[model samples]
Target chain A: MTVIKPKIAVYKFTSCDGCQLAFLNLGNDLLKLTDAVDIIHFAELGMVNPNAKVDIAFIEGSIATPHDLERIKNIRAKAKFLITIGACATAGGIQALRNFADTAEWVAAIYPKPETISYLATSTPISTHVTVDLELWGCPVNGEQILTAIKTLLLKVKPAIKRDSVCLECKRSGNVCVMVTKNIPCMGPVTQTGCGALCPSVGRDCYGCYGPSENPNTDSLSKQFQQQGCSRETIQRRFLFINNQAPAFLKAGMKK
Target chain B: MSMKMEFNNQEYYFLPHVKINALLDYLHHQGFSCIGPQIKQDAIVYEELHDSEQLPWGLRDYQMPGQYRLEENNVKRAFSWANGPQAIKPQLFKPKESLWRVARDSHGKLTFKNVTHEMKPIALFGVRSCDVAGMLIQDKAFLTEPFVDKHYQARRENVFVIAVNCGYSSNNCFCVSTNTGPQVKAGYDIALTEIDDGFVVTVGSAAGEALINKISLKHATDEMQQAMQREINNAATMQSKAMPFDNTRVVRDLLMNNLDHPQWDDVAARCLSCGNCTSVCPTCFCSSETETPALDRIESEHSREWDSCFTEGHSYIHGKVIRDDTKSRYKQWLTHKLATWWDQFDTSGCVGCGRCVTWCPVGIDITAEVAAIAKPAVDDSASE
Candidate 1:
């Protein structure tokens, strides 16, 4: 009798590669994880199979380049279950800040040769181009969430991930509301709760690392930010940070 | 000199405002960690206090919807404010705790170890009446069940409550409507009422009597007792803050009848679904359990952490989420808290400390929400 392990793959496109590092950051769990699933392809682990037919494929990063556009479609075709990890693939990442500005102007300002770049004007999420089975949200996805997602995937069950705003977890951890108590312009009320409220616990405001929580009340929080004396630009900039292209934040940033 | 003293089945004494440290010292002498509100990060948080200096004496908090500010009060009353950010919830029902440990030995047999603690006496100082009521509500939750939370039981057993009858109320207080506040009626060892020059302390339990008898306390004069009662009455009247609805019955009935009310959507548009209300709520007792397996995959520990209904994962069952929309989730939270809690616990869940209103980022007021629903529909055709 043979026990068959699920074939797993990790791929990256145009991200900072921080999301894939999350898989490696599972230091102790990484060893035990190998016993549970077969890692057929992982560039971070030095195994590079770009077209492996995998039982589970964890895709990180956004579709930035024209070539990336075609490549993600191919990966989607081969993966039985495609899971988007981090803000890059779920919502357009920090680089999606370009979406708010002119791409040609940004390129002209940053690059020496404008004609050399072959990137898309808007750095769009993978789900924008290809269908996604699930999304694990974060700036750099939480390592524990990745392990939990993988284990749950192998067991053919959905991992328990909270879609509530960070304010919930922040309060549960007994952190005084920074926006209320300290009068800081925190995005915790609108941001998803995967990071276990790491920033707010330390007396810092959250910048929506996990993208918009379920039906985030961006309108009301924006009004609160204004009442707290946050200038229009400051309120706009708050929404344009990590998960820039998330619909809720994008709308807030664009609003008057 | 231990004079035979009796007042309402226990001893009654007047503790001078300057020697309030004596009470702290007395509790400390009895092998208990004195826990009280101290200013931390601009908010009053419950922390271990070694002396009266740690208490928020001479400091008063101004709390409104979406705002909290601490200011100097020259009056120098120790228990000036009604309550703080943290309640008795964290002291008894912990935010996060390990329930038990499961380990697979060399023989491949799993061994279970219960996460237990030796009961230690905790002297909870300056606890408000609403919180004492909240603790009793939680006692019904954790103590009496087909399953009991032993960890909570252990902490609860050795608690020495030193409840503070409110000298004043904050802008957000509405405990009068909840019938849980403005005075410490029961569920305390000792109750303190702060007046102009001193504190009128009344013992509520045997332990409280023994501790008060140990200290050199002047007998509370009839005038002093009347003055204390006068202060308590003033404090109760000063709570002009009342729920917009008539009573808990009206609020509960409105929620029960108006399941599809557009008011939910109106509130949900402002509601962050952040669970801040539930987390800060003294009576919201939903929790979720998780297993933490060691790197070896053999040793594992099971733990339960505070969970809120506002979270999408909280309603997830059979591979699908029930409350997918923010409106629905908010509806479930408010309905459960105001209405169904009565069905489950024979009492309303809200104690009306108004932490939910003050702590909410958008400052969505529960009282207002309840009132909005309870209003007679002017236009029946209106839709969410």
Candidate 2:
């Protein structure tokens, strides 16, 4: 009469461990999650069987090193569903800023012993190496979004993540348009909605932490930023900030 | 009494500025929640009104393409601004609401329940003429013969509309050209034109007459009537923007014929396709539905939220996105709003309140787009 619980694992590579905190921060929900699934390998939560075969594998961070490149491929083979969580695992995160620059120079400048480091020439998302079942995008994916994904997966259904812009959420929440009213040069028009229009709701411009939305018109948004008197560097930085390696944002940031 | 005689016998009343609260109190006593325009987060938004003092007074909104600013004016008036991003549309057709829910028990049997919220009768105060026009258009959309939306109808039937005639026009306003504003023409229980001293009220229905009769008011004098007319005329004349054509048929034909014009490419380049224009548009009624099951998989709720044609999902049918590009999506929105809307609903979707223009983050003006398509510039460079 008992049902076998789905085995879940949390893996990290070159990320800041912030997205893993999204699961830990699920306070009471974390306890309830234990009742629903078997957490076979979340190192932060003290469970550390990394090689265990799991029903679902939640991967965080970019494939920034030789070890990450090999580890992700092994994890992909072990897991039935490999879902990438946060900006790093999906779009190479803020560290992917190194992808645009000379990684050798960055390592030499930052580290006292550059030869001690064994890293890839360019930081890249996990999707670059192995197939990703789904991608939960954000600088640190929110707890609610993580829960929604797990809940939908439990029901044997695909998670319904809206691919609309942050502007839609801002309108729904009845937040005044900061870009239009205060000339804040908000990226809400091109950014995805997972952050729930967080920055604009607090009178700040969106930094596009959740990454570029579906069919984002980055060229038009760049033009808008220029019209708002934003410097070329500032406009580029806006797109290249958190989810730098995302294709649409990378193309936008690299534009002249 | 004959209809003409009854109309001739009707009297217009003047409700002084101070007596506005009394109207709110009367509506409250009648079990109707009053909602009116008030300054919130630097914009005039419709919220629950417990007192008339909450209305935006001595505040004028300066709206342009992609900009809105609230400035204090010496003139003390409540309804001086043109309109906000939202109207009475959201009040009835909610942004998101659960339609129904289904639950499964341990026995593996399922049960369904309709999730209808207990709605209170809402008395919308300070609604503009264009918004009133929007309400009528929505009524045609949601309350039509074959498939009437029960949730929308439930809220629509229990609503009281108190419209206000515009005394001033914002920079993007073109209601005069649309022939739908500057004065409250139809679709209201009561219409109020604000003068210096008070509001000159026109009762459009028996319900309006009943409410006005409860409040002791002076009959509108000839001077008061003249002042109201002057204010309305000023509003009409001050508008700087206009559609390409006054006639809806002409506009429909113009947009329908020039479907493949280069102007669409020009607009598509500037457009972010963010759905801001559709969200701000009072008449745009597209919605999308989603079903969310509880973590336990024992219960699930099906809900609908506001959707826009700008979204790629809106054009998705049978695993194929028909309008895969921004140009095609923008074309769908403009054509459907101005041209195809008439063929579907027998009325143009745009009411020309200009919320779409002002609230658009990049300021893609609908009127200007229409004008470009209607009259393309001469290709003198090619000749040279």
Candidate lDDT scores, in order, read: 0.84, 0.89
Candidate 2, overall lDDT? 0.89
Q: After superposition, how far is residue A177 of candidate 1 from its true place, in Å?
A: 0.5
Top candidate when judged by lDDT against the true structure: 2
The TM-scores of chain A alone, one per candidate, are: 0.96, 0.98
**Candidate 1 Cα errors over 4 Å, as ranges:** A1-9, A23-56, A77-81, A154-156, A231-233, B1-10, B17-19, B103-113, B117-119, B145-147, B244-250, B258-262, B293-300, B380-384
What is the TM-score (0 to 1) of candidate 2?
Answer: 0.96
TM-score for candidate 1, please give it. Answer: 0.90
State fnat for each of the candidate structures. 0.68, 0.67
List model 1 lDDT by residue over B50-100, tens digit each.
877788878888888878888888777778876778878998888888889
Write model 2 residue lDDT over B97-131, tens digit each, in one string.
Answer: 89999999899999999997987889999999999
DockQ of 2: 0.75
> Considering every candidate listed, which one attains the maximal TM-score?
2
The digit string of per-residue lDDT tens for model 1 on A112-136 reads 9989999998999998998899999
lDDT, residue A164, model 1: 74
RMSD of each: 3.9, 2.6
